[model samples]
Target: MSDCNKTDFTNPSTFILLGIPGLEAAHVWISIPFCTMYAIAVLGNFTILFIVKMELSLHGPMYYFLCMLAVTDLVLSTSTVPKTLSIFWFNSREIDFSACLTQMYFIHCFLVMESGIFVAMALDRYVAICHPLRHSTILTNSVVAKIGLAVVLRGIMLVLPYPFLARQWPYYRTYIIPHTYCEHIAVVKLACADTRVSSYYGLFMVFCVRGLDMIFIAVSYIQILRAIFSLPTKDARLKTLGTCSSHLCAILAFYIPVIFSSLTHRFGHNVPLHFHVLIANVYLLVPPMLHPIIYGVRTKQIRDRLLRLFTHKGM
Candidate 1:
């Protein structure tokens, strides 16, 4: 082995990120859509936050949870997209070792927090639909604040170990990450040491965060469905189910991509590298882009308020 190869840059001062293994030539073109999606995510999520904060009528647990989801989406997408854009636009791919870990931490941190927010939103829907009379009392401001704090803390605590564990491994193999960002598995895969622990912990974190949250969301929806079906009139059932459409769409948009990306990363060994990278990028970008659109279009209150706000400004 060459002396350079033998040298243990236990932790390389910096790592090089290959935008997309085989698609570097098309990076400029690919960035267009990614940039657009990110723009929408930023604009739409901020709009949700602003509207929710200003609209007295939207002062409720449901809107509060929407605000949480919006913020999480913003952080989650922001964690990766700007760097990816720089790589595409300026060929800037060198990320500092600590910065890589910071990116990984925020990416996973807000991701888990987003999942928790989804669960909280699911419960909010369950209460509003299943126990209409007690919705306000059950999800009062105090309880909502507590849930938000718990969600934030849970994300911080659960993902806190990712960086610590990854830091232990010596990246002696190669510093060239063949993807846009410092994805935990991607970064750790370069480490010369045995990675079974980090890999296993990552899987455990996924199950504990996404899997368990999914199960809870599923159960909440089940009860919600039962409550909807129990209603005496078809119209009543439809109206109640309608109330959940936005949340359902948001959940599907968020989790389906996440599951697919995680599975492909761990198990889809046969999948092409570019395809995997593309899917991963899409998973991060799509939810944030679609979330506000879903809620704005499906939630009548938001849609109407938005229309009125725009119309008033136009006039």
Candidate 2:
């Protein structure tokens, strides 16, 4: 109701984000874990990026997707970790309206880009497995570059409406985002004007992008399975499947929680905020944190290269 007043809303130039409730009582205790996760997320993704770039053997389409994913993970985590950590350490949760919108834009942009990358990775796998004879022709260097550009453009286009819709709300006073990050829906909730159109559009976009990505991934894997089944030798099948294992695991880890959170947010609003926050954070942070480890362990060459790099640096 306080946000409904035009004068009061316009007068307040900044708004505070009330980060995860109950943290105020145990800030010091929470800081240790939060800081540790933040460090791991950043360092882990950076290490993956470094390893991918340093190892010349990983210069193929597979590792290309991995590198792009690592970059996306870095950008994704960096978009929110700083503010989340600051809330715990400095107890400062206030954010300017403009800054809030900026953060929301970048966060959503990277997220959609990540989704696009996943789709592209699926296509890469499809080519490698289902149509090996033409894999090189289908997923060439120039094609990968074009795919990367398309992903960025798609992400920007999809998320552009969020900020535009947000700016049109002339009566948004309190900017107390319930969650730790500048999620689009969370920011839209602060709008004094009716957000039905924006919310519907956002939900539609979420489903379309994520849905299409998932469907394509599924179709790719199905074809891959068919192709593997037709192979005469067990060794060939195993080798082909082995190449896809890490990607399958990464895709499952990333999409499961995201789909779960999206469903809960849309249909399970009756669920407690604690449950929502837990699911949302896991969806955002856990996949990125786990992705590098998954790939490193599954790919022997990358693992060995990373070990040698760490050994040389005495880390």
Candidate 3:
């Protein structure tokens, strides 16, 4: 077994993030759309957090989970966009090796954290839908805290090794990453060492966190559906389904693009490099931007409160 720590790194000083290889001429034009989307994502997720804080009535398991989601969205987007935008807008692409690794660590950590929170939110929805009477007891403050801690720890445990692993691998060639962000795969691909171990470990972590959680979430909803149909009244069914609409949309918003983007990148040989990078960027950007909008539209409390908040300022 070759140890990466003992290996030498060629050009160990800095890495160049080449923003969209062939489309370098259009970077300024591209920054417009990217910057707009980033602004909306930051503002939208921030508003969700602020509203949750202001509305004391929202101090429940459902909203508490949403708060966690919002915070994760904020951090997740923050991990990549500013640096990405800097590259696009200013051409300031040189990053110190350690800083690059640090950025990569946070990006992977926050991404896993975001996915874990969705699973937590799913369980919250399941409890609220399937066992309404016991929901409060089951998802108590203590329980929520425990779940939140677990989600954070899961991210920490899984992602901590990624940067360390990448750092140990010696880079003898170009330190230029073609994409906007410092992803584990992108960075490791530049290493002179064989990446089989790091690659497999990353794949395993993805399966454990996102894949397993997705499976559990599916089962939870299946059980929730069974419980919902067993309700005696039509209003009860509609009311319960209404409560789940926002969460269901959130699930779709978070997963659908990721699945599509992942599939295309892994399997689509004919796909253009720029197109894949763009799709990948969208996968990260769209969720946080849509989180508040989806919840605000589907949730009457958030919608009405936001309306009141704006209307008050006008008066």
Candidate 4:
């Protein structure tokens, strides 16, 4: 282990992904449910964007941000599930080194991009409720476009370093990533070289991306709360609170699972490998699956349009 050569630092040309840990025998069955979830996630998010685009009345600040969220969900789900299903059904586990890197980059990139969109949505609600008269000028479509551009650029810049930093590190040991997905930190753990730099950068990226977004979102809601309370009647407060339910559902669904998954990844050494794998997979899958459903059910605009599109029914 002490002996180090130049080759020790060379990137492994390929890697094997170990699908679900103890459930190897049941991987085929497991993939059935996994595929169903992925189908719903992809189709659900696409539906959100499709309805938003089709219905002119749905064209507004909130729905525009919803479109961005749907796009991120689509990217996030596709990046992992297709390869994951292949590994389960076809026994295709070997992934090219570059492809693995690309997957890791997109996973983190879209994950953070999703978080950024949530923050943007929170800000949208804050402006809508807190400063109602100024909401139009404040959250104009042009401004939303600028925010979307910033979010995309931010995610790209933050996640870009993961691959570049890992590419230079030599892998003297095994190239088998234990997790089903090639997450940034999980893959970084495979490098034989000193990975402190990349590890810390990954942590920083986590804080900059997820942590900062969560902070801003919390702050936005706090201001929004005060504004809602200032309303003259309880009905007004309740109605305002109701408007935020979808965003709140999304934040809780994503952040709670993510927090547990991160903790298990960093600290849960005694935890079963499958347990860790399950939480991580769910962390990614649940939001995309639920976000569109929550919005469709909770937002009258989307639900009405979807119902009309489906049944050609009612005024």
Candidate 5:
């Protein structure tokens, strides 16, 4: 496979995603549930976006980050969910080579953006709690806009090499992805050419983006916790922590499975295929579903606003 020239485009024009093995035989049964989950994920994230946008009171740094998160979830889910559902529904799991790279690029791009948003949320909480006097001044509109621009530019820079490396790889006649989505590692592994460079680059970007973001979040929360402890009143301490509880929960839910999945893929190759699939799906789906619930339940303002919106709509 490596012997084939990169210029030789005469090989496989379309790649097939093997999809879920057992259910591949029963496409109809699989399609219904997958499609339903996709719809719910999209609608739920869109609702979060709408709530944040419509409620002017939710325009603070916290909600601004939340809205950005909602958008990321929508884009992330959109990139893979529809394609997965289509595979099950129509038994049409074929994706073009260029299309696969595009999907992989967007998936990775949003992933980095999501991490950036999490870091920004942590900083917002830190300012609000630790430096209350300068919260507004520190997280001003101009500053937030700059942060957003930085996040987008950084995300693009981080993932740009992936598609380029992928395009350079020689494709064998066989191009079948085992997973539902166009995962970066999964696609890279299929490259007939030596993928050492691509793999190393991917790992480097993943670590730099997620690793640094996690460290920043950890340090921010440490400062926040220190400030909380310095508070004279227990209620003040609890209140300050409570304000970030939702974001903390979201960060945990989003990153833990992802980190675990990546580790399992790298070090636990002997593990069962089903175990990898289950964890990977959880990493993708669980956060999108849990995010709105975490924010809505943890933040009374969001919950009340949602209730009022539904109540008025009911009338």
Candidate 6:
């Protein structure tokens, strides 16, 4: 009981991660699925990268954006999953402070990058379908390169403050984090000092960066929908919408779990701790695993290439 009440005046050099507060007994069993998802996410994203790189026909803005998304998913998931699995499977819960901050930075950085990639993809589809005549001219290779660069810079600039701000706060409360990964809020809340500024900054980064990205995507899609509807024939509209199906699936796969997890963490006070941890894990793991599969299945070009590759291998 005394240990529970004790506080450390110095910032911890190492923080202990309690994988899931109430689910310790099930950690081993839980690790099976998490491990499986990580493996699949890695394999699937690499396959997407492979397909896009090898297919000359895919040398366009859309596939370039897909490659960006795949790479972001890889980094985002890799930032947390291995450590999480270690906590679950081997009971290796202590993470070095610097390592934790690095993990936090990579996870949020790639998350923002992924959102920007989705917006780029939406714009790609909008131009292709809405203004086919100018699609080539507008989304040229150089323009796509510029957009990618901007996305990378935006992510870096926005998330760079997280670790610095976290470092400044005095973590006298406890060195134990009740989650698998070093989330910004999870780490900051351990500080005994006032954390409202850090907390509000997190909210600001989310709403300002991701919120604006979402708004851009939404507007692009509205314009896309108008263009699709204006098509004279049902088949024409269907064909055009088909091109966006994979992107739409990817967007939902990315945003729903993320938004739910963020809201649950900040606002769902009645929610169980284990449930919150599970949702946080799901938001990171599920999207990466699902994204490549969604694109592979919905995209006819990629689907055909995958089928050919496997069939040739079988032969």
**Which candidate number would show the highest TM-score if scored against the true structure?**
1
lDDT of 5: 0.83
TM-scores for every predicted model: 0.97, 0.93, 0.94, 0.96, 0.93, 0.96
lDDT of 3 by residue, 104-167 (tens): 8887788888888889988998988777799889999999999999999988888998987887
In candidate 2, list every pair of residues with a backbone clash.
Answer: none
- For model 2, the run of ten residues with the poorest summed lDDT: 3-12
Candidates' lDDT values, in order?
0.92, 0.82, 0.84, 0.87, 0.83, 0.91
Which regions of candidate 5 are displaced past 4 Å?
A: 1-11, 22-33
The RMSD (Cα, Å) of candidate 6 is 2.2
Flag the better candidate by TM-score, 1 or 5.
1
Once superposed on the true structure, which residue ranges of model 4 sit more than 4 Å away at CA?
2-9, 313-315
lDDT of 2 by residue, 1-315 (tens): 544763544323666876676546775676676667767777878887788788788888878888889888888878887887788778788888788888889888888899899999989988988888999888999999999999989999989998888887765555577877777877777777778999898788778888888888898899989999899999999998998999899998998998888788778979887577667777778888889888889988888998898799996
The lDDT, on a scale of 0 to 1, for candidate 3 is 0.84
The residue pairs in collision within model 3 are none
Q: Report the error of model 4 at residue 121, Å.
A: 0.3
* Number of the top lDDT candidate: 1
Candidate 2: C-alpha lDDT? 0.82
- Per-residue lDDT for 61 in model 3? 86
The model with the greater lDDT, 1 or 4, is: 1
- Per-residue lDDT tens digits for candidate 6, residues 67-167, read 99999999988889999998887899999999999999998999988999999999999999988999999999999999999999999998999998888
lDDT of 5 by residue, 1-315 (tens): 545663567435778987775556876676675567667778878888888889989888888888888888878878887788777776678999889889999988988888999999999999999899999999998898888888888888888998888887677666888888778888887777778998788777668779999999999999999999999999988987888899999999999998898888777989877577657766777787778888888998899999999999999
Model 6 ranges off by over 4 Å: 1-10
Q: Write the per-residue lDDT of candidate 4 for residues 113-189, one digit (tens) a residue.
A: 88888999999999999989999999998999999999899888877888999888777557888878888778888
